[model samples]
Target: MKKIFFTLLFFGCCFLISAQTEPKVGDELIIEAQDGPTYHHIKFPKLNILVKRGKVANYKSVHGNVVIIDDVITDKDNNTYVVLKKKDGSKFFGYLTKVKANYEKSIASGEMVVKS
Candidate 1:
């Protein structure tokens, strides 16, 4: 009994350690240009907000852009929201979409690619 319990515990620990903890702060990611101009998987900042900030909210414009994980916000529900910025420390055209997304989900759907 002891042997069986210890073996199960060891495997559980391994599984937990190998689990994916993606979108960690400071991670470099690339915006993947899916077949369409709009990114349906993840939300982008509102067009009006972008334009109000003297920017253009062109979905195609962000294609292939390299961004860094600037902030990671996790709500009480365990939903994750990531704030991304350009590699140069400048914000994205839309900026702060405040959308809840997991990097694994986006990456799996080809919305974002892990650069580093």
Candidate 2:
């Protein structure tokens, strides 16, 4: 009886830990581009040229990547942003568009999600 109780307790703790650690919206993630070493590029509002996300900006680690939530836009454009911050404090933004075939591949592969 004691052994069974301890086993249950151990499993319960493990479950709680895993659940708590699961990624959520606004959580940053490190991802690699499928095409090559280059990061994903996006044309953001008020930006003239396309900005890239990932190693190009020197945010190679997970700590540098920032998950973006589109809570501000209530429309159904199905677009989300991912922000990357460089060591020099520069920030670049990219969008996850379902309309784009390349982005669709990344979304399907679980490389990027709305809320993980």
Instruction: Please report, in order, the local distance difference test score of every candidate based on alpha carbons.
Output: 0.71, 0.40
Flag regions of model 2 displaced more than 4 Å.
28-65, 69-116
lDDT of 1 by residue, 50-113 (tens): 7688877666767888888778877797767677777765545645533444655677788988
Clashes of 2: 0
For candidate 2, write residues 1-116 as lDDT tens digits.
99999999999999997675433344433344434333344222322333323323432332324344322221266543333222233344434331111233345564544334
Q: Whose lDDT is greatest here?
A: 1
Number of backbone collisions per candidate: 0, 0
Q: Model 2 scores what on Cα lDDT?
A: 0.40
Provide the lDDT at 96 for model 1: 54
